[model samples]
Target: MKPINLAAYFLCGSNRESFCDRFPSYFLRIFRSKECPPNEEYLLCGSACPFNCSNPRGPVLCTDDICGEGCYCKSGYLRNDNGTCVTMDQCVGKDEVCGPNEEFLSCGSVCPLTCKQPEPLVCGLACGMGCFCKAGYVRDTANDKCVTPDQCPTEQCLNQNEVYDLCNGNCEPSCDDPEPICTKICKGGCVCAPGLLRNSAGECVSVDKCGNYTDGALSQYMNVINKILHL
Candidate 1:
């Protein structure tokens, strides 16, 4: 005879014990004071058996056709307050949504698509232990949408780096450049002056190819110098 399933019998409760007592002696096993009973009718009830035990005699699949309604709904399924369909929204991270292939659950809400947060109502990029939203995004009303923190460009992006040195009205060392400026020195003890390049022997040569140092065009080279300087 098949071994009596103790767990199944326990779930079946007194119905299983009474059924065994009324039927075959092979359905019952006594070990010390413990009496194992045969399978009682497996009553697929509530959401726990949402597909109605998968038995042909089971009820059809419907959100409202939950077994054991108000009592149990499988592992993840929950009963609605009105006791109609299982509450799909209660799944949250548990089921996310009823999977397309499974008949156990129905659709509720699309899970929130944010990176790491499991609950659908949360917002913004999921952060590390100590990290906060950097700049461009902010915590929205639902705590969702790491939205543009401030109006674009009007207030400028927040400097995420804690320490900042200001150059004029902007951050120093320019975000794009590494160096500040290049200083020039002439080899022949001659002051080649700014706005000019030196030759091999240290003769100050106009960047424009040897014009007088006092030429009005020197101011133009000075402008170029300022353009290349980062800070």
Candidate 2:
């Protein structure tokens, strides 16, 4: 028989001895008491079992989705109260509008397109982690929304490192000698800066964790990459 998932018991109040005993005896002996991250960081209802709180069934690809998926706003949506989707004007007092194939997310200043912060990222709130793309989306710097990458933007696209440095949404046609590789480019798109990869959530992430859609982004590598790229 397939092993029964014991993770459900790990939720805050569900950790009674009766629930703990549900596990096989052999597995129970080595069991440590349940540990919980801060409630705001992970609420059982919103954090686990099939992503997207606003639309539980979610997109077509979410049919077999797993637990604790990276919760993000879908394309054409911006975060509103409690991290759910809302129209552009509803995203606080800011007047940011997401164009087609895009959504408002706090992609910092690096991403060409961005949204206004709903609230400062102080600890006690629901969206303290900030809004990002849905599980299968990627942020497009040019248009500023989550997008399904159909194909590479160009044949002469810049390497990961080069893209990270420049690409402020203005792809110039030509320039002086040694004029950044994207000189003859127009309408620059995001192509994962150095050491970054387009993750399933449609955000640029480190290459190491890109292959695993459910895996969380590693923080140390993020800090290092940010320092190097000045993002």
Candidate 3:
């Protein structure tokens, strides 16, 4: 190989003892290659992989991936949008705070619902801070949304696969959406079939019902918005 370019590599592995015989000045054994090589051809496999990281905050670490070993940012640091290490604080979102009976959080609403206790979260830490449900309202673990007990269907046999969802009494496959972008996963929203409507009793009646979809194309942002507006 080109020895001039070899100045950028380090001598390592069991072959180091032998490679150094021809290039004694460039030998670094297991350490970083701090010296440059002379201008000429030289054996290359005798050299070890070079790790010339420029991170000033921490030592370089190696982790295995499909491409073998890979470089990663040091602990408490993360790669930014530009692939540079930034302090952990930069990676973490700002704190958040809900309302009474809700929890205050440093992260945004999209963050996962978790608790600080050693055991599993009670009510799965059901409620979150900010615009929490009105008084006497609690979040339903089945759907992870806030609702008053009266909102739930009295039947208690409701689920995504049941004849009707407990929260909205819509038929199964309520979000019969064909749009690839919309999700069919129901999170307690209600929709009725054509020519049907949701009666005051919460049952689907003729031509007067409600509606609902899949995921990425649409979001439950409207659902939350409606909740905020008490719609």
TM-score of every model versus the real structure: 0.18, 0.18, 0.21
Please identify model 3 stretches exceeding 4 Å from their true place: 1-68, 92-231
What TM-score, to 2 decimals, does candidate 3 have? 0.21
lDDT of 2 by residue, 1-231 (tens): 212235434532364565445654434322321222212222222333222333322344543335442333443444455755554445554423333443344332222222222112333423312345554455554554655543223334454433522233343211111122444223444354544454455455444454533323334444555698785
The candidate maximizing lDDT is 2
Q: How many clashes (backbone N, Cα, C below 3 Å) per candidate?
A: 11, 6, 19
CA lDDT, every prediction?
A: 0.33, 0.38, 0.35
> By the lDDT metric, which is better: model 2 or model 3?
2
Best by TM-score: 3
lDDT, candidate 3, 1-231, per-residue tens: 556335434433346456666765444321223121221112223212221112221233533221222233333333445555454335334122233444323222332322111112234334221233334555554555555655544333332322333333223222222122433323344444433444445555432122432243223533543577695
- Candidate 2: misplaced stretches above 4 Å? 1-131, 155-231
* Stretches of model 1 off by over 4 angstroms after superposition: 1-71, 84-231
Query: Looking at candidate 3, what is the lDDT of residue 154?
Result: 34
Instruction: Give candidate 2's whole-model lDDT.
Output: 0.38
